[model samples]
Target: MQVNSEWEVPKYELTEFKPKAHKYCVCIPVINEGEKIQKELKRLSHFASVIDILILDGGSMDGSLNHEFLFSKGVRAILIKKDIGKLSAQLRMGFAYALSEGYEGIITVDGNNKDSVESIPLFIEQLDKGMDFVQGSRYVPGGKEVNTPLIRKIAIKLIHAPYLSIIAGFKYTDTTNGFRAHSRKFLMDSRLKPFRNVFSTYELLAYISAKAPRLGYKVVEIPVAREYPKGKIPTKISPLRGNLLLIKILFGLLFGKYNPRSE
Candidate 1:
């Protein structure tokens, strides 16, 4: 499907390995993830028949996204971003493309293999139960957290989750987790206006976290496991810079800076 320019998505190249096979899809935003993404995709392959899989790549210079490997693993498509922007931009491409192709709901997961892909069925069950927004939470009762960095753990539990919960009028124990599901009804709501160019980075995620509850969407958080490798944190973000960015996005939410513009 040709993306309408008015949708505000970045220019992208998409390759479909097969026709759409499910009512939902898992849109993974990735770039230069090397073996991590391949391993994740392999794990996700077990659920291929249950939901479609697509990659929203930020131009991987690394030779990780081989088409044949993806096809062998049951990935249905890949959307490579050809324009500037970061994770949010790739996600914009993912959401817009999935919706255009008639996916009833979209599930987003980080492509780095930190999340447990096995718990995907739980999210689908919630979506089936009329949840407009489903956030995966490692801090919740049935959730598991393993080998997390002390600083990142503190930041998520102490700062990010608390701040977002207050503004969202909902207690969110795992606000930073990207393993979430969104219904078509929630995404199509005009009041959110998520496709704007302003959401180039972390803005869209934070904005949606706050706006979903305020707009009366049926929101819920389910337990899921997240584990980091025992040796080093696999991230491009420096600790100080990443926290600063999070603080900035949080402030924007505090002031309603990302609200939909009036027509």
Candidate 2:
């Protein structure tokens, strides 16, 4: 779908579950998140009336996101990615669709049932207050976390958050958290071409983290719970390889590699 003439997005097939019913939407990116996606949607469906729900599927063959289940959960639409890309490509598709559908803002959360679905309203409140970007954090006053891996925690606290905080000139406690919100104005900014093919993996999140606050957009961090289950964590990224690539992306962002050049 063409959000605007300037936008470019990955190829995908769109499936509609219902008509657009709200000004804001929740865009969840998933792949093979069987029960986790189902559980997340069920809990999130409580607020479906207030905000539309969308799924960006990365060609999941896990039989988790069938049309009947999604329709029953009040999903507004689903975009099954047929293109060769990862999380960021799916995001490009989701954001473009949301903007084209005339959504005023977008709230994005992980599909893996780890984040606080209850704190979704808090992000909505920030967006309604004219905030352009909002990052959710489990390290803040009212935020909570359970069963978070120690190494992952250490990397985020020591490396990721601090590096980005310095770049943005704003303290962000949870830089890696995908639980965030973005306004149409911020996403549509000419200086930040978020729809590009460059943001294929873990780059866009890092780019947005630093780029938004540095551009002097209205950015805020809200407290939210991120719980980890005691057993297996549902993550696609392998720890060693994923962390290295993320670090590379962070450094690239620092050097302005992802920044859109002036035409």
Q: How does each model score on TM-score? A: 0.97, 0.97
lDDT of 2 by residue, 1-263 (tens): 34776666888999997899888999999999899999999999899879999999999999999999999999999999999889999999999999999899999998999999888899899999999999999998999989998878988999999988998889999999999999999998888889898989888899998989888899999999998999876567777777788789888977888878773
What value of lDDT does candidate 2 attain over all alpha carbons? 0.91
Please, what's the RMSD in Å of model 1? 1.2
Estimate, for each residue in 97-215, the C-alpha lDDT of model 1 and write its tens digit: 99999888899999999999999999899989999999999999999999988988899999999999999999999998999999988997888888888899888888888988999
Worst 10 residues of 2 by lDDT: 1-10
By how many angstroms RMSD does model 2 differ from the true structure?
1.2
The reply for model 1, stretches above 4 Å from the true place, is 1-5
Q: What is the C-alpha local distance difference test score of candidate 1?
A: 0.92
User: What is every candidate's alpha-carbon RMSD to the true fold?
Assistant: 1.2, 1.2
Give residue 217's lDDT in candidate 2 (0 to 100). 98
